[model samples]
Target: MSLKCGIVGLPNVGKSTLFNALTKAGIAAENYPFCTIEPNVGIVEVPDPRLADLSKIVNPQRILSATTEFVDIAGLVAGASKGEGLGNQF
Candidate 1:
């Protein structure tokens, strides 16, 4: 199974920074709204120090860890879908 998550909030809300920290994508901090149409998606490996310990205890053939994805979507303001102040066009 696969899972996905999206990072959404007001502009300059630090969404990209948070996504970069989570996914380590190193997205450049250029002009606001980088990739106005596309968002920066990052896949972050879950940090689990106990996975190996558990594997050793269980003597499993393999040790697997989970991962998470972070998406830095363009900021969407209130009533955006309704075209309220440069909202519908985006």
Candidate 2:
């Protein structure tokens, strides 16, 4: 199963920075608020020794690692739940 995660917080709260560090996508993180209007998605493979052991035991042609998806959305502001900022849209 694939796991999904989201990085959300107030404007300019290092959400993109955290996503960049996690996925290394480097999708332009700036100091200004709302730098990321649209949500940025990145997938990272999870490394597990159990998977390798299973691969060796099953001897499959190819072994695929599990993945986790990270989404970096626009910063949320007060009243975001009320559709104040772009966070609601994300």
Candidate 3:
């Protein structure tokens, strides 16, 4: 099974920085609010000790490791319900 994780927080709160470090997606992480208008998504394989041990014993042609999806969503702002500060767009 796969898992998905989203990084969300206030504007310029290092959300994109953290996402970039995790996924290495190289998205435009500017130093301003709403820089990440579009959500950045990336999938990375999860390292499993069990998989490695199994590979040694079974010697399969290929091993499919589990994966996790990380999404960097735009920052959330106050008054979103009132459609303020581009919050509604996000």
Candidate 4:
């Protein structure tokens, strides 16, 4: 199973920057509020030498690396709990 990590923070807080660095998804990280309405999902391969060694030893037809998912949710503004600034839809 793949692990998922969600990035949640206020606008212009480097949430997208971190996500992009982690996943290299090239998502738009604008300086304005509510720039990302829909969440962006990215899958990243986890590097493990043990897994590679096992794969080499077993010689599986298809070697699949462990993966992690990163999700970039829209920025939450003030009064978000009360349905403000992109609201609870996030």
Candidate 5:
């Protein structure tokens, strides 16, 4: 199974920026709050030289690198549990 990662934090705290950098998805990182209401899902290739070497030795038809899923969710505020900042629905 693939691994999933969720990015959660307060508004305008660079969470989007980090996600954009990691996934290169060109997601907008606005300066204001609540800019990212919907979640941004992306896959990142995991770099492992050992895997490449093993593939070379085994001579597989194709080399598929492992991947991880990154989910950039909306920001959370103080009252997120109580529906603040749109709550857990994000």
Candidate 6:
């Protein structure tokens, strides 16, 4: 099975930074528009102290916390709706 997530916003709104934080992966973050032409995506294990504590107490063979995916896609402009930039992606 597979899961997916996405990050989108106006250019330079910290979308890429947040994406990096979420997935703990490095993606090039550049200024100005159209910096990201293709999307950047990553999957990572979630770090949770509570889940670790529960595992210690319950002694379950398996422990699971929520995992999240991150994707950095190109931003858009108002003309996006009219087919400009990565607007079609939006």
RMSD of every candidate to native, in Å, equals: 3.0, 1.4, 1.8, 1.4, 1.3, 2.8
Q: Write the per-residue lDDT of candidate 5 for residues 26-70, one digit (tens) a residue.
A: 999999999999999999998888987898789998878889999
CA lDDT, every prediction? 0.70, 0.91, 0.87, 0.89, 0.91, 0.76
Compute the lDDT for candidate 6. 0.76
The positional error of residue 40 in candidate 5, measured at the CA in angstroms, is 0.5
Q: What are the per-residue Cα lDDT tens digits for candidate 2 across 1-90? A: 799999988888899999999999999899998899999999999999898788888999988889999999889899888887763897
Identify the superior model by TM-score, candidate 3 or candidate 4: 4
Which one wins by lDDT: 1 or 2? 2
Question: What's the C-alpha lDDT at position 48 in model 6?
Answer: 71
**Per-model TM values vs. the true structure:** 0.73, 0.89, 0.85, 0.88, 0.90, 0.72
Better of 5 and 6 by TM-score: 5
Clashes of 2: 0
lDDT of 6 by residue, 9-86 (tens): 777777778887777677777777777878887877766789877888899988766766777888866788888766
Deviation (Å) of 48 in candidate 3: 1.9
The ten-residue window of minimal lDDT in model 1 covers 29-38
TM-score, candidate 2, is: 0.89
Clashes of each: 0, 0, 0, 0, 0, 0
Sort by TM-score, best first: what order? 5, 2, 4, 3, 1, 6
Superposition error at 48 for model 1 (Å) = 1.4
Task: Give the Å shift of residue 82 in candidate 4.
Answer: 1.2
Q: Can you write out model 1's per-residue Cα lDDT over 1-90, one digit (the tens) per residue?
A: 235788877766777777777777787645565333467777777778988788888998876678777777877778888875347443
> What residue runs in model 6 are displaced by over 4 Å at the alpha carbon?
1-5
- In terms of lDDT, model 1 sits at 0.70
Worst 10-residue lDDT window, candidate 5: 81-90
